[model samples]
Target: MGTFSAMHYRCLMPHKPSAHVRRPTPQRPMRVRWWLLWCAMWCLCGAPALAQPAPKVLRYAMVSDATTLDPVSFSDIYSVEVAGSIFEPLYRFDYLARPVTVKPQLAAALPEHSADWREYTVHLKPGVFFADDPAFGGQRREVVAADVVYAIKRIFDPRWKSPQLPNFAAMGLTGLNAVRQRALDQKTPFDYDAPVEGLTAIDRHTLRFRLDKPDPRFIFSLTGTVAAAPVAREVVEHYGDSVGDHPVGSGPFVLASWRKGSQIVLARNPGYREVHYDEEASPDDAEAQAIAQALHGRRLPMVDRVEIAVIDEEQPRWLSFLQQGLDLVLLPGTFAPVAMPGGRLAPNLQRQGIVAQKLARPDVVYTVFNMDDPVVGGYGPAQVALRRAIGLGYDNDEEVRNVRRQLGVPAQSLVPPSTYGYDPALKSEMSTYDPARANALLDLYGYLDRDGDGWRDRPDGSPLVLQYHTDKTLRPFNELWKRRMDGLHLRIDFVPGQWTEQAKAARAGKLMIWFLSWNASAPDADEFLRLAYGPAIGGDNLSRFNLPAFNALYDRQAEMGDGPERLATIAQANRLLLAYLPIKAHVHRLQVSLHWPRLQGYQPHPYLRPFHAYVDVVPNPVNP
Candidate 1:
């Protein structure tokens, strides 16, 4: 474990107001000469002769909305990403964007394990205050050892409603036996059960954690935004239902307000401190330093305010930035100015001294055909026809190279080649979209236009009507699918709504086809295969693809521990999913995003979301 610390010193320097010492009063040439000298002095010292210097605020926008504010309730990347900005965990990843070491966040030092690796001890960082204001009946006080104990307990508290309970139980912590038993036996009220027997307060600034087994990745899990953060125990106990909607955490920003589907505002935490990296500098030096400065002892909204206005449509988000109303915007690469028709967005940005960046996002999009549905049962007549239709339906290569402008690679498998355990050969096995083969297969399958109506009918005399469910988030992709599927005699009906609703329809077997993606900032094949092929992991597994063989393989991979053997098992599972054809990976779109001229630092983090690791957004000019 490496200590994360920063040096602080107060320095008083000369300054002059650049605006007030203006025009030399237009009274004398001598005065103008003196002004030039003063300006030179300001530049040399990195300060103005009569100007005050201070921190600035950074404003940004999100294309997608956060599903839940409750950390323990869900583990979706989007929610976690937002949570990362507002919460603090015990440790984080290194500059390589890997969880190379553990550091203290709410804790003062890295945890120490006993000889058996089942027992652990940790020291808490003293004087860490919650963001809530004490004057408003809120407890804005230093963090204590008991807070950590409470947080770990809440993860398994049935009444607290944490979605991470199962995962927590999987950690095999014997100390939580009492908590689990109490909840199960109804000894404690639904939400009042405290679950850990090993968490004890050595002092106000120290805590100890004892586990039942050796867990090397256990510390990394503490880096997670949800379960690892210590919330205000009093606020949570009293506020109850309102805590999730308005959380009080020990981070740089506090929940100012949320208007639901409209906007969420966060004011800076005055108690934040700039922590220094150890003697060695991490590769994320630039971004890490900026983020540290912005969070520690910085004034709110470096300027007057930082606002994220809600716009349902992506076009307006781009337009607002084009007109200089917004500072930064993240949108799909296809709609980005460079990838847009006639180079629209790029030119506009250049005119305003702004830059448009197309970044390679670790996100993949696919169409999942429910293999377990009665109407779409695997190997059934209807299912076989549907699978054949997919193979001959769309020209993926053409779409990837021309329509999407190679902003993405033609996806042949769920896992991209860049990820661990992903096979490169899977790309060649994907469909080539030959019309002759498609027509012959359809005729052989009894999908013929017997009534001579241009659309083919099944043996049962019903025309094939494919209900394609997609969210409004990717309207462009949906439109392209409709146009591309026209030649297949497929009546593609598009339904655009919220993804959550679509997900519910998928799980209930109401959807014939679903277009969606699994986003992973860390390029791990397990993240993709585990969700797609494994027994429907919550909101994922749109296809309802349940294969005993794949499920067995997935379980074995998880149990195999961290090594090459696990990687091999994952590859086998992915291959099984591909052979079954429950999913058709379309294209691996490159992520593109833009920022205002004022936003100082906005970059991608390889292992996690940008908001998690290192990023800073400051006002254009230093605010006084």
Candidate 2:
């Protein structure tokens, strides 16, 4: 069967041309108009030139589907990936800038802060309009400061059950948490109409944010982040609970069609504001400079449409990419030997104009030993010993060499590479592999063979079986895990399940253990540390770790500016994660993105997700 080119799928979605359509001549004056039109057409162009040009389409694939399209409620990278295309944040990362510089998107400029750094004032660019929607009574609606306020308020509203409530509230937004508490305590609807001193719309285009205390890096929350993208209040109220299904935004693309878990298609927002390509590049960066020079004056989102398919497995996804069904794919490490041997693109692929870019991804793969599980969970010395031993037995280096094909480094801390608070010099037991010590610890903790069954038993003489929940993609990793647990003489079971279902189970506190990775959304370690924060149990803190001392350290670090004091406090939190052993941190992965030559000016930003607007589709006839 003939599949796609993104060209094939674009035809399946609705076509709403953003460009101006030509009006025909009037009825009575038709003959005269036709004569004049023909004369003008003859004078201006030939028959071949009269034909309309095909719309440019870009295509790609992902391993998983987004949890939700709702901008306010999602925490997973997949969901944010979809939301990033459809929503517009106040600020965005500079497309080609190294070190990831934050520049204005909807905001006129960066905010001005008060002397004490407790307040920040931002002015929105005038005439920025939202895409045409029913919520605006069939009229074009310009985005204002109030829309941003409403977006922020939605996170605090209890009805939404947003996972970001703890995150934004911790940013020192003064009345944000109190309002949420009031709604919960009084059992009333969240009062969005009520005044919030911390988040105030000064006027139609100006917004002022007042915080309870100084937060030097709070602006990072506003830059090209899904949490900072503003959705219209009218759209939310009109759609009610179904707003996620009907995402209406002023971003470069509009959600044209969604086939739930199968495919996602987006059309260029014809009504998108007039913006031009003008990204920054370093002096020595030839590739970025060339890309910027070529695309400098073009209108934003050079592609006319985008199609992303959900492809789960490695071999099929790789073959699809090779066959030109998809223009770009995040190349899995399993195929690194074939695609880029010795960290260089193979000659055959290079001859086809296939480009490869690799980096040490700013993320950490970790196994969560659920703190709520009876077998794996507890704060006591015996339980701690069991977790620590398990952590010590598994070798991250082996996984990197044997499983990952030397595409990653053994993770030393919860904080990922290139982010603040990641002390490479600081050592911990997170990556230690000592079977002797692990065996001793297991024996001392009473996790042993009482019935002489070869496998270890619980302290109470019950069966000590560990139920590990994971998706099929991690089967190789799971095999290594099984072998390591065998060394500890511990019995374990692998329960295979879908990512979406298993994630829900993990969040509901029903899973004993699950392996997952957390990629950095911003250039901050705070995102990683949130996994251990007491209040984030139902959110990013999948482990449900709730230690008072650890929580205090997290809070203490958050309150201070980016300096030695904050770094010291963050260090304490990292050490505490090791002591508690709620999670066994593994390797920081190496991300390899392979794309065909047709996808122009494409480069993977370390953490930035919304990059469709920055890339263009100039089809290569040679490849086709």
**Number of the top lDDT candidate:** 2
Off by more than 4 A, model 2? 1-49, 621-624
Candidate 2: tens digits of C-alpha lDDT, residues 360-431: 788999999889889999999989999999999999999999899888989998898889888888777899
Q: Estimate candidate 2's RMSD in Å.
A: 8.8
lDDT per residue for candidate 1 within 309-348, as digits (tens), equals 6565767776776676777776544464353445345564
All models: lDDT?
0.61, 0.86
Error at 505, model 1, angstroms: 5.0
TM per candidate comes to 0.74, 0.91
What residue runs in model 1 are displaced by over 4 Å at the alpha carbon? 1-55, 75-78, 94-104, 107-124, 133-138, 141-220, 273-306, 331-352, 356-358, 377-388, 423-464, 503-512, 521-523, 533-536, 561-563, 610-624
Instruction: Tell me each candidate's RMSD, in Å, in order.
Output: 10.9, 8.8
